[model samples]
Target chain A: MTTPGRTTAEHTAADTLEGGPRRGRVRPGGRRGVPLPLLVPALAGLAFLLLPLIALLVRAPWRDLPEQLTGGEVWQALRLSLLCATAATALSLVVGVPLAWLLARTEFPGRGLVRALVTLPLVLPPVVGGVALLLALGRNGVVGQWLDSWFGITLPFTTAGVVLAETFVAMPFLVISVEGTLRAADPRYEEAAQTLGASRFTAFRRVTLPLIAPGVAAGSVLAWARALGEFGATITFAGNFPGRTQTMPLAVYLALQNDPAAAIALSLVLLAVSIAVLAGLRDRWMTAS
Target chain B: MTRSARRTRRTLQVAGAGAAALLALSACSSSGSDSGSADSGSSASSASSSPELSGTVTVFAAASLKESFTTLGKEFEKDHPGTEVTFNFGGSDTLAASITSGAPADVFAAASAKTMKIVTDAGDASGTPATFVRNQLEIATLPGNPDKIASLKDLTKSGLKVVLCDKTVPCGAAAQTALEASGLKLTPVSYEQDVKSALTKVELKEADAAVVYRTDVQAAGDKVEGVDFPESAEAVNDYPIALLKDAPNADAAQAFITLVKSAEGQKVLAEAGFMKP
Candidate 1:
């Protein structure tokens, strides 16, 4: 017979460790030895994850990398990618945190279904998601026809469209992370503040927001990373135009078709950016609770 | 047993099972290779003497050849018993790169001479590639030609959204040749990665027009309307097919090539909007 309670406790501990830096410090004594059974597959999995990265570094056109990286087109794409990813992250934070708070703090009918719908973009193929975006927001689309006639707005084949595409695919990561953090946080602090004559909104603004700041930061970092790597949706919905809508991934893909060395160089730049972002956020989010 | 002892025992059992599985997997693979070599040796011996072909032939062809080649592949299988034909359809340049990179393909059919040159330059092809068909460019407009686009010059009209394949692709290169021949300067709303994607933009009505292959316009059926311009004759893309230098099933690959160049094969290609080379 399986012991369900014990397994659930182990799963919970594993989830917390997967949240990162705490894994290094929280269970120091538990790392004396890994059983051979787990160690073998764990090492294999590590190699599987790392071998492609090692191959990239090995076959990287190091001799031509300097000139390739310095090209005007390379910088244009990198700059666009950074700007759009940051804007998308900002947009997600403005809207997603409140949604997470609602899901965690409020009890409403069909809340479960609403939450599922919010996260639907994460699983939908980015190309399909892009098509859906077009159908709903294209020039002759359902809501888009009105926007075009009344507001003179067209979302496709522009920088703004790139941001919308990234935001569409990335916000779910922020909402899920922040919602999980909000659920884990104690809600009684808000109640105590309310009892002291603070309004519910005031209690939330002053207390709950501060309590989940770390989670929000972590979520923002994740959303930013996802937005930076967005390709299919951006290309399909926004279309690829250099200096306007071509993000690093789109540039990387196009370069791969024509110039492989250029693709590797662009990939290295993206890898460096990812490392820098994660390293920058480590101190704030990875510490033990 | 104590909980710790039980846990250790279970871990050991798992480790032992893993080792056994790995050993069995390696053993099976070695035997598989032995049988594979034996079968190939027999096939090679029969290939030199026998007129009948019986082996798997893997052909890497351009994406545009998908429908016609699939039909040809089925007909080839029916004519030759105990033979199988497999296809890997993609961009001609991509397939060329793969062949040069030592991908195990028995035959290669490229969309353009430039892409075929890559494989030939690398000395991966057995002989000079033969031109099998010629493909012309067509303006794929939304169903009913809603934008009323007629000639290539109409695409240059302000506020008319047009999409074209990226210049790296065969269709894009052909479009460029035609545009230069006509002395026209047209800016597209977007340059898609492939001909199909460019056609998709017209089908979805996102763009008023897309410059794509006549075959693609035909395949799109009621989704798009094809407009033929006289300038398309100035930039016809020739499709080339060649046998690889290191074909695993050379006999079958050769026979498959023969079938593609036959009268029946030409009928299929013509139906798919390919012109005589």
Candidate 2:
């Protein structure tokens, strides 16, 4: 009745009740489910969601599509988007891990308050974040003027500025995801490793890292994707120009403003690539199983 | 262990992709290529028989023409019994994109000839575009012209924070030409996304000055001082109005264009600080 694992079992039961069990339909040999209420809404939502892309396909000027896609600038923008997204993810991980650990493990006086503040970026509008970034890191910003004069480094309208903006909007996703995984995970592994000859940091790196690797990986992917499609912050903070700050999202937006067909095609390409990457990751899970 | 980590990473990627799709689906809007004027109430059809315009005529005018267009829009409504006139005003680039994307519109009035050509190039314009109004740039400085920015050259003072529109929009393109003509290499603090935003930086005291149109400066009156610069003459932007090829309300569109070229329309345009073409 008082088994040590009972609380963990109850916690998981609650998680299942709250919808975690149904996150994926992974049951083996289950009838090709007939959940009409959920299925119909899901299908209709997907179609409604894809209608614009469908319209883009229908109205796309196929003859001229080659010219648009063949542009070197398109690839340049695409490359920039991928590069900045990954870089931003890396930056977020470098700083966000400790922040997440502090929230998850270490107790401070304002720990609860601090946790809420760290997740602020998730709710804050991306444009507001861009403005805040500008106010804080712009040429004449409170701290940026020093950076400008002492370093001769202006962040606005530059590639680095794009990374900064993306990071500002994307880091919260990583923090929250990692924090959730940390809470779900068993910290006893760390204690066991510490009971051995290893120090706390060593135990963390060898034992803790392996145990929460799933969570860390999940957070990184979240951060990466958030950074990838970032538009408002990148455009507002970095400004749009070819071969510089014009990431795929900015190009897609500017294209959408003038040419809807081109916008759709670009969107489709982005979707396809992101799906491929995500699916490739999914396969890794299968292999792990 | 690493594999399980990778597996979770994969799940994270899927979630990220799912969120992106959600964002795209939510924000996606058609390239509204059609002007809003395409709507024709039954009464609007009477204009064809005897030019006796009766019902409503919707005009999708450019953002710069807000005051003048509003005044003229009201006057046109009064002149034509039961003739309602509505306006869909925004950046010319955005308006053109909307029109091209299938925004139902009759008459198209754009801030610059270039944006009008985007429609014309698509063969959407019924005929050749005519320059209806001309607008020149003005140095929108803070109240009292605190920067003492008398000429174009003075804007390069290194310390002054200036704002200009992005090159994709007509206002920004014109500003670039003005700067090039004056041989000034002044870099603005930022290339604002739109004309109003560029002017707003000055109004909010965020920037020392802004390069905006005369009409924009007038629109923002008292909040900022409009300083005349000779360089603006070299890059006057011509406003163009036309009837689209897919004009659902062609008669109303033509009638509205006629009213805009009328004397009353000129008075309205002048009152809003538009220069004579």
- The candidates' DockQ values read 0.36, 0.13
| DockQ, Cα level, model 2 | 0.13
Candidate 1 collision pairs: none
The global C-alpha lDDT for each of the candidates, from Candidate 1 onward, is: 0.88, 0.79
Tens-place lDDT digits, model 2, residues A164-208: 999999999989988888888789888888888789889878887
For candidate 2, the per-residue lDDT at A160 reads 96
Residue A84, model 1: Cα distance from true site in angstroms: 1.0
DockQ metric, candidate 1: 0.36
Alpha carbon lDDT of residue A242, candidate 2?
Answer: 71
Model 2: lDDT of residue A86 = 90
lDDT of 2 by residue, B120-195 (tens): 8877889888888999999999999988999988888987878788777788889899999978897776666678
- By DockQ, who's the top model here? 1
Which runs of model 1 end up more than 4 angstroms from their true locations?
A: A1-40, A284-289, B1-55
